[model samples]
Target: MEIGNLNDYFKFFVALVAVVNPVGAIPVFINLTANQGIKARNATASIAALSVGIILMVVLFTGEAILRFFGISVGSFRVGGGILILLMAIAMLNAKMSNIRQTKEEELDSTERDSVAVVPLATPLLAGPGAISAVILHAQRHDSTLHYLYLSLAVVALTAITGLLLFLAPLISQWLGKTGINIVTRLMGLVMAAMGVEFIAHGLKQLFPILGAS
Candidate 1:
């Protein structure tokens, strides 16, 4: 089941959106940059988005080799990553941020730091574990360089959309308010949960071919 078809590529994009949930991260971006000037905030947004794109692209291309170095199969990693993403989705569904993405310590640390565009905002916050895992798992579905290129493009598109959202964070925050943001988060959470389950199911089937036969 190579990611040669448009549907598969679209699913990859959707999964990235569901897990990334840029809309859900708007409030965080706003709060993190609240003390900064408009220009500074915009700069932060641009840096964060660019950082996310770079991180995901690197992971997508090098992830399999990293797993091989650790002697971990894609199927095993999928199950582990699926559980992590599922936990995140549950937190999102409850309209709360997951500690898995950023712990209380990290949040506090960000507040004390002068620059947070790359650390909390970009790394663990935007391009965190679930996002990286999603890229790796999706990359495993490819059999050719063309498919890898398509996946890389998808990553670019995801970051582009996220960057745009962060750039409009203030306006989006004013428009959505807390309640609207929470509603959107919950909806995205539902989608994330579904994707998490799909990852786990596929991983299980791969690890145990008998399950696929059944």
Candidate 2:
């Protein structure tokens, strides 16, 4: 078996980390499962992570094909997707949920449901448009089977990390406190903004090859 490339894996992790921002989701996770017992909370965390991992894995492998079916070019996708990620980053920095990722409707809906792991937690919160775009972009950049496997591994690893954090949500909240979480959120936002800019730059280079020559 081919060894996984650290550099590629790092890139995947960075992009995924910035987009997923599992740390940023702690408050919401805590709120969503506030009434649940420890076992229920742990189960919720696992399901959310598993669901998100599945969503990302599917997109990572099939996003290119989906774009092709829609006749969307990588350059176009990068520019558009970058914009989405940038907006999310801005919201993250502001310590608010982006409407694009999670809306008031979803929040309200979550309160009514006994199980929110698959809906708001996994679907939009963890694997929403921002995360989806980042994964597709990652797939576009690293296409080899080995690299793809690495990408898949990164998704699993990140999701597992996310789950662990959620499982320990109460402790994390207590240790980090609200102020600490906000600080970390902003820092992650900065990293995400950087990723967005890189995406736009790369896409522009493709859309206008002349720029690369100059």
Model 1's alpha-carbon lDDT is 0.92
Candidate 1 ranges with C-alpha deviation above 4 Å? 1-3
Candidate 2's displacement at residue 49, Å, is 0.8
lDDT of 1 by residue, 58-129 (tens): 998899999999999988998998999999999999999999999999889889889999999998988999
Candidate 1 clashing pairs, residues 3+ apart or interchain:
none
Off by over 4 Å in 2: 1-5
Task: Please list the C-alpha lDDT of all candidates, in the order they appear.
Answer: 0.92, 0.89
| lDDT, candidate 2, 87-141, per-residue tens | 9889988987889988898789889998899998998998999999999987887
Best by lDDT: 1
- Kindly give the number of clashing pairs for every candidate: 0, 0
- Using alpha carbons, what is the TM-score of model 2? 0.95
